[model samples]
Target chain A: MDRGGRMTAVVPTRATAPASGVRAAARIVAAPDGRGGTALPVLDGAGPLALRRTRAVAPGTAQVTVVGAMSAPLGGDHLSLDTRVRTGARLAVGSAAATVSLPGRCGRSATYDVRLTVDSDAELCWLPEPLIAAAGSDLAMTTRVDLAEGARLVLREELVLGRAGERPGRLVSRLTVRLDGRALLDQGLALGPGAPGWSGPAVLDRYRAVGQLLVVEPRFRDRPCQVAVLPSDPAEGEAMLTPLAGPAALVTALAEDALMVRRLLDAGRQAAAAAAG
Target chain B: MTITTTAPANRAALLVLADGRFPAGGHAHSGGAEAAVAAGRLYDATSLEAFCRGRLDTAGLVAAALAAAAAAGVDPLLLDEAADARTPSPALRATARKLGRQMMRAARACWPSPVLDALAAARPRGAHQPVVLGVTASAAGLGPLDAAHAAAYEAVSGPATAAVRLLSLDPFDATAVLARLAPDLDRVAQQAVDSARLALDSDVDALPAASAPLLEIAAERHAAWPVRLFAS
Candidate 1:
């Protein structure tokens, strides 16, 4: 599953998940082949996870889907993913469905980590489905992205604390993005009843769901990006938007439900598109 | 924790740095209290105490760690990047830099150190506020633990002072809230200094990254408020 100019030894042994849940890992590396085709130098998956590439929707762009067991991961489960877009290549990654995380036995938490890299002049758009943390669940996730000069990236993340009428679980999420070896955005949050900031008005404001969108590129930095506020009831939600250093912008929203959070993300996406153009 | 240093530590410098009237541009900002008041989540002394305690442990702890690292003579540029990574809200980042610039202006006039001048010349726009605080403390002959105390105190004091104005709550109550949290603040400062000592040996990334999402989100929302009393 490992390929390219440099040949690295691949560990063929796979770790199996327990009957309660699954521990999975995957890595995808895309490069431009001299033969005019997109070269997948690395495509590997373990446990119940699978990686699939769909037909390209545009020139130089390839779509990737994450296929996995539909059941929620059990407590103490770990999911890891790594992706790389080589020079001159474009990649769009999406998930087949939402990930539901269940509580681990004996108070153990599940974790997910994703590491992404984009070479110079490469583009990446990762729009994954919302993550639902079931009641009594404890989950932690971290995503780190490294971008070379001239790289373009659009990333979105959505989180729902729990299903309707259920109390939310604990969640700790972190995102670190860098451009040309300089930090662009570094953000981390701990939510749910156990976190100290969970009840603060400035954190979740008692909202059940939250979403964030980050757009980074040289073209979007100087341009003003405005986030549209949906005229919802005061008790429903609120949205915030700001431009960061190094041609980046972030839009965050908190809402009473998942659909409203999605709507907020759409507004941000539109604004990002407008800024990029 | 053993701190290997050549210079004697100035204990009195902590009081000067932690003073509310430090002219560091902190008076204009409420530490997200303005937005909380607008949202009706804060009203009386009870909720204010809760809010201050939360800020003390999360954002306050992180800031103290960063400041301690800076005072410990760790690279300022690296600490600045770590600050940027720990802070997620763009508006909050801008505010930190703005405050950092103001602090630099005051620190240069008070301490008059070559390091301060070099940092100002390099980051003309300003570095993160905690980073500047740490460097300023170092230049003042203060130890990393002293810087942590100042940072941890400021974290709760800023919000407590703001609540008095934003809610028209009794000034005595706000002051009392901070007084009650003195022991917890000491613990947080100690923890921050410990973490900073570890960071000096390993990576700056080892510093605490505790965050308040609503504080960041509210700062962004507050930035767009056309008629707000506070700057952030």
Candidate 2:
């Protein structure tokens, strides 16, 4: 397939040569139709990526799979993804899960970038599981999303600082969100800065882990809804961290300080749950 | 009402950030109230304050970062990108944009400055709450520390108010959370003031990479639910 064409495919097969890594490319071409829909293209390291129907699984279905791999293994290697969902079409993309190996002296890391384009009336949900970076490994990733007029897109990416057990020292991550040529969200984080206030009331308050989820659906526009957990009209589609129940209650009881709520967990789960609840 | 020429802009900035009525999409998020309720963690003001403080600390870092970035005259967009990087969960990012859009609306309504227009031009995008607050502070003639204070306060308030419902917190108890947080809020404001002087390296030392892991797990689990109340 032509590299410059709107719809193209590139896949490296084992027979082609004896390489350790695999490379694949797929594209979507939407005509002038007023309606939008997504074309699922099942990708393989050997053959051309083909379109398939969106798949669904049963409840309590928690399974993990690794779709592709590198042709050869080296001291440091990575995986990459480049995608663009056509306008008016809806797409939900996710990976089975990620398996990460620690980096040696080379200190090499794996990376992934996903570029999404949503046109008018189209919707996309890219909620992938957290990719754990083993100890001593450095990882960097970026997700660039472009939404056209009246388009809706939701892209979710989670990064585990280190495997729950492997326990990586530090994980650096970045994310950028844009719509209609305007940048809506840009965030960068480095979890291991051992400073004076590092784990104090002034900073993260010692939360060892971190995670966030972003959802952008135009359908919810002008609609007033509350999170299931916290059924309050969030003045804005936003909420931050509050103290944990244990610490907050204890502090207030002991110190007579109402702000005691400012002493507990970071904004990740506690805040989201409390606020959403 | 008495008026002071000393710094009328500071009061305005505070008002802009303080008013929960700002058009920013923040109204859409219950902070983690939804997640906490789902997790059975936040059931009352006792739990609500704890939840609010955690969010304040984690998100405060980002707000402080934005305040510092704005004080340094760095591009608000860059600060926004930095904020984005810090937030790993997609649900939170959506919440930010929703709030941002509202801030843009409020800014356009209350303060018709060029920066507000530029941000409005950016629309449903670009106009994140912190970025807009910083720029609006600049436009309204407030200092970085003051702007940071407003941003931090708003960050705290959004969740605190939501907790009232989740935990069935009494209005008096909820307001007490704010009053109690006074000293720390002042201290955080000072830190935000100091952070404004830091150089804009990708490191963003002003903030930390700490977030609630369980919250993320809940958000993911919440999104898949067929019927849910919160946007996060």
Query: In candidate 1, residue B122 scores what lDDT?
Result: 82
DockQ of the two-chain complex in candidate 1: 0.48
Q: Name the lDDT of candidate 1.
A: 0.79
Q: Is the docking of candidate 1 incorrect, acceptable, medium or high quality?
A: acceptable
- Backbone clashes in candidate 2 total 99
True lDDT of residue A119, candidate 2: 73
Residue lDDT tens for model 2, A229-267:
322222211222322101110000000111111122122
For each candidate in turn, give its C-alpha RMSD to the true structure in angstroms.
Answer: 6.4, 14.3
DockQ of each: 0.48, 0.07
Error of 1 at A193 (Å): 3.2
Candidate 2 is graded, for docking, as incorrect
If you superpose only chain B onto the true chain B, what TM-score does each candidate give? 0.95, 0.83
lDDT per residue for candidate 2 within B1-232, as digits (tens), equals 1111133445766676667876666766666667677655667665666665655555765675476456446666656665665554455556676677777777667767876776667554644567777777767766677677777787667667776766667989888987877676766666665565553443343443334444433454566578766676
Writing each residue's lDDT as its tens digit, candidate 1 over A1-277 gives 1111122222212234464456678899988876655667787866545788877766668788776543545577788899999997888888776666667554678888889999998889898877777788888989889999889898988888876677888888888888998877776678886776566664676787888888887887567565344345557766666666567877777788777777777877777677678
List the candidates' TM-scores in order. Answer: 0.88, 0.47
Which candidate leads the pack in DockQ? 1
